[model samples]
Target: MEAITPFLNANQQISVDIKTLREAPDFKAGEVDIDIRNVTPLFLNQEEINAHYLTTYKFRLYASQAYVEEKGIPQSIHDLDAHTLISFTKDGLFPHTYEPQAIKCKQHLIIDCPLAIANAVENNVGIGPLLPHIARLSQQSLVPILHNQLRQSLNIYYTYPASLTQNRMVQDFYNYLQSLPEDFLKGRTHLLAKRPQKINPLSDF
Candidate 1:
């Protein structure tokens, strides 16, 4: 929200609400002019709501250096059984293709917020999946586990009522959002340039 504040004119005012993407309130009643969400709500009326695909984000399993040194690195899906797992309290908007495999590991903790989960993993609580951008932002030196194997992707969207599409303030905000640098939206790979050396998958240890 802070990123686009400069674009608003003197007559324009803005209100921001942060909540789960699925719980985004209806904008048809004119309560909101724009609703930015990570996932498109299922109940959104296609005729009434206009959603613009913003960008795609990828997630990978991460483990703290402390945890890796203590439990040894997991090289295969079955190896996860020997390590503790951290997960969200609710299944998130991302796809669950890798969930079944994750369930096989012993769950060490469940967190409601993604940031909190990353913090716990960083504190050496357990290994868990998180967005690479977020992990890097935390500045905790987390090792990417199964980097070539397990992964999930999500697309962010900017949605607004069809009626508000022509509103000057709304359009200006939309334009600013669209103009964001690609690296800012998708994150930079150089953030992970110093990532620890990859673990050998076939090592017996």
Candidate 2:
């Protein structure tokens, strides 16, 4: 936040309104020039914006290196069906979708929060997903489970208010956010400009 302050406050004519990525879809829902575009990942389809590509996370299964080395790595998503999955009840963090055949784990452990999920995974209660930051913090207590395929990162965006076009401060702030260090929007992985190798979110863009 401090790094971008200089840019946002450079002009005092207008104040920029910062909003979440989910709020961007409705930027121009009923207005004009309030277009919402996907600015990250430099996808092919500029029309459909995905906040996911702008973020990154580590994909891990709760298991010791010794155990995995002996059992072999999970080769497919379906392989997870045989393993217990610990997840947080918090909203918007875990991936959610309507799947008629979604498997119900043999033991669905309910944790109080995200930290609890990581704790459970560290104890080898079950394999689970976690952000890279949290994973790094908990590494000494847990094991990293590798997968045959890498997981897709999360996406985030900043929406510009339609009515603030004439405001220099607001527009400058928007441009500054657009120019934010890619790692700031996304998670730390490769260099900010280095695009992901496998999970190319821009295939639709």
Candidate 3:
């Protein structure tokens, strides 16, 4: 949402309501007025939307140097089974599961939040596939794994209601989101494996 904040701020012509669907008591298809739905690729039912598409999200995996050195890097599609899998099961299916028979299921663990999975992998609990954006933030502590077999991307959508007001602001916001820097969506882990300096703290007088 940060990526498109500028667009919303630029336009003052429309009133906006933000609601967390998870918190809504009567938030059913029949109750709420359907205006527009900006859906993420993570949606289990992309076919349900069948509307406008804005952009895509790429998913990647990260692992520890020890795991790679010991097991050897996975070189082909079937190699995912060789590593421990971490995932946030709130969405029901793994990101890569979108494709038919993409990876062989081996060891798997489900956490409640995105941060939880990221934190676990960062601490070298196991290798995990996550949004590149999240991976980038953790790169200083974690390493990316299985470069060849981990390639996949998902599309984000911006569905509009029949009566969506023709405001330049909404359109601009979508454009800004689409125009976000590539790095904002990707995590660079190769650099993390290199030598990193340790910081020491002492009591201040």
Residues 71-127, candidate 3: write the lDDT tens digits: 666666477576666764533324424334345557777774556777877766676
The sequence of per-residue lDDT tens digits that candidate 2 reaches over residues 46-112 is: 4432232222334444554544554455566556556666654332224321123244555556553
lDDT of 1 by residue, 1-205 (tens): 3444454343233433323333454564443445554544463447777777766768788999888999889998678888877765434322333244434655556664667778888899888878887778767788988878777776666666676556555565556658886545542110001112211000000
Q: What is the C-alpha local distance difference test score of candidate 1?
A: 0.59
Instruction: State which candidate, 1 or 3, has the greater lDDT.
Output: 1
Q: Which residue runs does candidate 3 get wrong by more than 4 Å? A: 8-50, 66-82, 88-93, 99-106, 139-141, 165-168, 183-205
Residue pairs in collision within model 1: none
Judged by lDDT against the true structure, how good is candidate 3?
0.47
- Candidate 2 colliding pairs, count: 8
lDDT of each: 0.59, 0.42, 0.47
lDDT of 1 at 72: 87
Error of 3 at 139 (Å): 4.8
